[model samples]
Target: MHAKADQRIRVTLTLNGRERSGYAEPRTQLCDFLRHELGATGTHVGCEHGVCGACTVRVDGRASRSCLMLAVQAEGRRLDTVESLAGEEGLSDLQQAFRRHHALQCGFCTAGILMSCEEFLSRVADPSEALVRDMLSGHLCRCTGYTGMVQAVLEVARSRRLATGPDSQQENNDV
Candidate 1:
């Protein structure tokens, strides 16, 4: 049996470091819920089949396709959208690196790529250019040609390694 399109459920989750709740039909995609109900418009919807990766968000500390997930599936999960990247101080290191390297142009594919790169950096503190490119294979960008994005990721990795020192690099890599 399929859930009625109008049957809305109260979905709750930790979004962008804050507790957020919204009503969504069982059939509603998470990206739609976040954008329409929760006002997380930063998680753009593109190629809803999950190929373009424009709708990526961090769910439980991993990059996930919001368009491919149901709203109910995000309940109790810690979700981080592109909106969470900037703080009062301004853009995050990764975001700053993106800006400096001109990693984005049209910006449609940037949010998803940023989310994926953020997760990548968290798991791999010191990554080679090949590895960064491999990780970027999941995303598609029509504007920047990926050279700038690749450079941004590498620059951020190097900066983070320097900021945290060599000892922390090993620990971060082990994660």
Candidate 2:
């Protein structure tokens, strides 16, 4: 009989608007791959079993728990981490809104929360307070209650609507 050997899988994905390629074991979690292999430590790993949303990231514009997905499973997918929300021009609308609204505390859960909020706002521009609460139920934050986060999301939605007019709601759906 032959002995079992470690398997390395190659994956290519778009990360933070750039193309990234790497090789990892089939069992390697996406969170580890992003933080260790790719050095994208912005994706935190609070709970490895998907209980906490600290490892949240956008996979094809959908918020997903990186700890639950294998690195190989993200092959040929588009991934966006917290780092992508900022640039030379400064923070994106979501990042700015989080900061302006004081939605973060201890900063441990900020990245994941922002990622989830980004996804949520993209899907529903003007989400109700109840909807915001329900959407954020998947995440856990020990520092701040859901009040600040929900308010930040709503603020961003309102700003987008005001800046682009009511028709701007359609733009968020494409994200």
Candidate 3:
């Protein structure tokens, strides 16, 4: 016998460094599960087909489009949403840069863009302006015109490189 189409499955994953479990239909999108089941509303849903990049989240340390993934597919994986970026003290460096640069206007796309940038900065310690722009091309923001975002990302890159030095390991997400 096969599972019914409406059958719900228990999906367990490490979310924001904490183990989380929720029940959802196997066909439910990861974004929906995160928002409705886990109460992680920061992961937005836009252009569910995945072109808009508004549903971006970190899956096992890489930026992934949650809208493109099924909730069941995320079981047993480590996932990080925008809520994971900040600490008890304050916002992360990347978030501070965005705020200082006025990189967000309406803020609908900010969460996903921030998640993507967090993953990018972790891998590229000293990113150039062109590369930063390239990485941001995947996201879509109706406001802020992308200039402030580019500047913010570059500033964070410079800060991370200066803090860790060129030869040192890449910046950590907590920084």
lDDT of 3 by residue, 99-135 (tens): 9999999999999999999889888777888889899
TM-score to true structure, per model? 0.94, 0.93, 0.94
Off by over 4 Å in 1: 1-5, 170-175
Candidate 3 residue runs with Cα over 4 Å from true position: 171-175
Error of 3 at 170 (Å): 1.6
Worst 10 residues of 2 by lDDT: 1-10
- For 29-130, candidate 2 gives per-residue lDDT tens digits of 999999888999988999799988999999999999999998888999999999988889999888887777778878998899888888887788678999
lDDT-superior candidate, 1 or 2:
1
- Distance from true location, Cα of 92 in model 1, Å: 1.1
Count clashing residue pairs per candidate. Answer: 0, 0, 0
RMSD, each candidate, Å? 2.0, 2.7, 2.4
How does candidate 2 fare on TM-score? Answer: 0.93
